[model samples]
Target: MSSVSYHISNLLEKMTSTDKDFRFMATNDLMLELQKDSIKLDEDSERKVVTMLLKLLEDKNGEVQNLAVKWQNNRHTRHYQWREKKPKYNKGG
Candidate 1:
């Protein structure tokens, strides 16, 4: 795997660490990575990241859960904006 992918994988694994601080740091790093336009993940990796974030919502730590919810909301809002700006094609019209 490329160095970037390897680093991302490591961060994702760290996100699930038993230590709350590690998880918090990992989440913050992942958020920063996601906000970068140059950082793109394959479909499967993207799905995995989203699934992991969603799972974080059920974390025993309140801070982790709150951060997960915030990230999810931000992701959804960004997606909505992208969809709004993307041109649509009419089929069979």
Candidate 2:
């Protein structure tokens, strides 16, 4: 895998950390990476990132949720497969 994917994979792992701080930092770092025009993800990585982002939208910590919201606007373009996954955690979805 490319270095960028490796880095993103590491960040994704951190995003799932039980510690809120780790999730926050990983989301922040991920936003920066996503903003890069050069960053790329294979199908599996893209799915994981989108899934994690959707899950994080409900993080108990408000700060992490806020960070996840920042990515919402660009996610469609960044991850084309995003349409395949919906936020099942949402009430009455």
Candidate 3:
């Protein structure tokens, strides 16, 4: 995940080459890595990843946008379910 942040930082720093395919590939890779349970992360890191993925979805290339949307949809479902879970309190609270 930190590696993805590194790539995203580099991509943001560049002036030229806003190639949609490149961005899309990077987003896809991040999403793939995020699916692994071994990759522990905090809420801030997760939010940053989601933000970058959304940007890739808005890329000019239609194919890239379509792929991003598919991935985004899957992400949305998981995220929504996680958010929807009710918080638990201690019995004495």
Candidate 4:
């Protein structure tokens, strides 16, 4: 499995790719790889990816928009789960 950072960077670049097939392939690959165990990323990087994907969702091309939505939803789901499981801490008053 490729590094999450590398895949994210590649996906961000390829999301703007001129070739529709390539863009689709790259997006799908990124999504699949994200499901693997080794792709670690901090919250900020995840947010950046979500923002980028939200922009892609507005693309004029139907296929691109569809793929964007797919990634966005998957990321959203992951974030939701993460937030639910994250440890809650509070400082003394």
lDDT of each: 0.88, 0.87, 0.63, 0.75
Cα TM-score per model = 0.84, 0.78, 0.63, 0.76
Where does candidate 4 stray beyond 4 Å? Answer: none
Which stretches of candidate 2 lie above 4 Å from their native place?
77-93
TM-score attained by model 2: 0.78
Candidate 1, residues 1-93, lDDT tens digits: the string is 877788889989999899999998898888888888678688778888999999999999898898899899999987787679779889877
Task: Please give, for residues 1-93, the per-residue lDDT of candidate 2 as tens digits.
Answer: 889989999999999899999999999999998888677678899899889999999999999998888789777565565555545576786
Off by over 4 Å in 3: 1-17, 80-87, 91-93
> Measured by C-alpha RMSD in angstroms, how accurate is candidate 3?
4.0
Error of 1 at 16 (Å): 1.4
> Candidate 1: lDDT over CA atoms?
0.88
Candidate 4, residues 18-93: lDDT per residue as tens digits?
Answer: 8877777776776787776667777777776677678878877788789888877777788797789778888773
TM-score leaderboard ranking:
1, 2, 4, 3
User: How well does candidate 1 match the true structure in TM-score terms?
Assistant: 0.84
Q: List where candidate 1 sits over 4 angstroms from the true fold.
A: 84-93
RMSD each, Å: 2.4, 9.3, 4.0, 2.9
Error of 4 at 69 (Å): 1.7
Best by lDDT: 1
